[model samples]
Target: MTQTGASRNGLPVEVHHNALLQLLTNSLILSHTTPYLSCYDVLNLAATSRAFRYLVYHTPQVFRHVQLSNVKAAQFSIDGIDRGGETWRNVQVDENLTEDDFYSGPLRGIFSSLRRQNILQDVQILSLDGLSVTAELVHDILVDPSFSVRILSIRDVKNMNERKLRAALQYACRESRPEGTPRLRGLYVFGPKEPAPELLLKPPPPVPVRKAAIPAPPVAKAWNTRSKKALKVALVEAPEPWYARRGDQFPPRISSEWAFTLMACHGIIAFDTVLCTGPRHLNSPAWGTVNIDALNAADVPHYGVATHSLGGCASCGCAPEGWTVWGEDNLATSREPNERRTSGSAISEVGRFPLLAPPPVHSSNIKAAMCPTGQPVNPRSCFPSSTTGKREKACFIPRCFNCLRDRYCNGCHRWWCETCYTGPWATSPGGHGGASNTGADLLLGVWNELP
Candidate 1:
């Protein structure tokens, strides 16, 4: 064995070198093969080997992203394991506080260490509702030139509103270098709705509608009757899926509360079918590139209008001369009284009814002509399958084909369902990964398995 280091510190040279080599090999393998493995898993592996400990100390990049919740302060330590090579040391001591309190502990130290060593490039923090660090704290780490964070997910921040959240995003976006464009690419803000008292104090603005040139038609007597009948039929046919087991239980199906919260915070509305709708508020020129479901046949003639509009297309910027007519038609057709009643009743029972209002006008702009009341045209069709070459299916679930519910198309790298497994969106021959619906199918299976 070649001995090189000054024998001052009590570490054996052979042990140190062995540890270093093991760490380098592990890091290299992990970096390439299992990039998405959690930080906890990586740390656990490091705890098994002295070389791993030294490697972890030198290479902070291994801890690029960390998700810590309600852990004891003692559970955290500068070194993952103790010097004795046996026990794990506890760095902090907080016994009374819950899991959430521990994670929000002035994470300045972790941030500083990562910055100094250049380890953290992406991070996600999950916490309890109503628990969030100040925007100032977030800004300090995210804006620091030394670190590069590409994705940030914060869960359970109840007090954060669109405006404050937007401000924080703007600051982070601004700090990124133009050439590099180091953005917080994927941001997922989640939490329960603020209390009723807070909502009552500041109710959301009413959804706006542009005046139509033609007089509004009288409420259709047939529609009202059909709607009520449909509701009764629906209730009889399928009662609400039991949320929990016979005993106590959290709702098994994703609730509107979760869906709407994600929608309002991230500007993405997720439906039961796994379709994700774009933010209805993002109508300004800056947000024109976002594409969503068409509001109605009258709003946009084609599926690309919303995408073109959001993407800053010159054609969409100029409001078409007769656009309002289309908008009006879409707004009228998009309204499903039966669906509305069901949603309204559900909301009212939870005491969150006041928040429900007419869907925003912007949403109407993307309303596809394929809805039940849609014009006699095809709405955005679902992905085509290999067997059904040209035909497209309708996504009955809340999610769209492009949403996470389906497998990502290898050819186009876009989300697509089984029906859309062929064509240009099909798995490319020499692509990174072939199109596989395993993940999505597993999730669906899990949902089905739920009691």
Candidate 2:
């Protein structure tokens, strides 16, 4: 008797089984390397067979870093006036489309269904912009204990309110935990302009200065004695202080305008280095020099000046001359424009001058030579730019012992501009430093460095 081998019609059953196993193995490997795979891809695989469905459901990285944008409500209506003596109203999505469009309907349905399965925890970064979702919806996602989203970046959100934004930030910060905590490490919220402040008070100091400097002593003397029988003392005049003989010109005194301007300038600087050379008609080199001198006088350290070229003269506009400038050119270059200020020659002129150091040719390999901590050095971080327009009128008031801007309201004890944190509302005015407050007094407190 001939035994019948497993077969379907003319095909052998063992041959079919091997083909199925091979296809399943290949699909599993392909899913690992694919980046930004949409939810539809996973759903299609799941529908292919029960074995494929299991693999798609269990893959963690497939749903990681999900980015969704331009999502609007299906029933929303847009109204526009037409030129043909009629108003045009358009309704794009309806019941028919919802039933027929797999992406707009069935895919959304699948995501909605998976929402209950806690599959969204696999999403590490959720970037939502120009979506019709409300702030309440954002809060819900952030507060959800099961959601593992770590970085939420929402930009160009026109409908978002400050209260909602602040609430969402507070929730994100609160929900973020050390362990088992949603890895929500950062929250970036940006818009065209800042919302009217609930409260605006004098920003805390190191008042913004254009070219703050560290002044060296006027003279250096060495003690000399001729034998024990005859002891002689000599007094030598020290070389000129960096600012000596220069006019009263110095860096701008730190003020609210300075802080805001620096923030604006830094933002421009980060995006394009050429912005440093841009025109500044309002404030001249002398103004910046005075501000720098004030910063030096205040003994506020941690800041450094950047210039086009190193070791160039302060007057020639070629080197970083702190607060000093020689006409249109930098101080050093003005004396001799034809001479090249090399390291050896730089020491000869102006005794010793800091030269402009070229930026790293390849930023990736460039590392800061010195650590910022334990010393006076500006901590460089990626900070947002100011949204306020330039040339916003800022009043500068000189309160003797301290050049304070915007009068301090005694009732509130806070210094304020026309907008917020004005008289009677301030918790503490003249807090940083003034005649009312002692220099050593812990009024404004000390600068806190960022990690």
Alpha carbon lDDT of each predicted model:
0.33, 0.33
Write model 2 residue lDDT over 1-451, tens digit each, in one string. 1225656555566676556546546644544433344455556756887766666566665555554542233212234422333422221244333212312332244345557766776766565544334465556555676566654545444345546544554444442434444344334332221222222232235535456665334442122113311321121222121212111111322222222222222311110011111011112222232223212224322221211211221113222222222111132222233332332112111101211111111111111111111211222332324773322111111111121223332332233211121223233444321123222222233212212
C-alpha lDDT (0 to 100) for residue 336 of candidate 2: 38
lDDT of prediction 2: 0.33
- lDDT (Cα, tens digit) per residue for candidate 1, span 15-85: 76575455456756544432344455665766877866666656644554454333233123334332333
What are the RMSDs of all candidates, in order? Answer: 24.9, 26.4
Model 1 ranges with Cα > 4 A deviation? 1-50, 57-61, 74-105, 121-131, 158-163, 172-179, 191-451
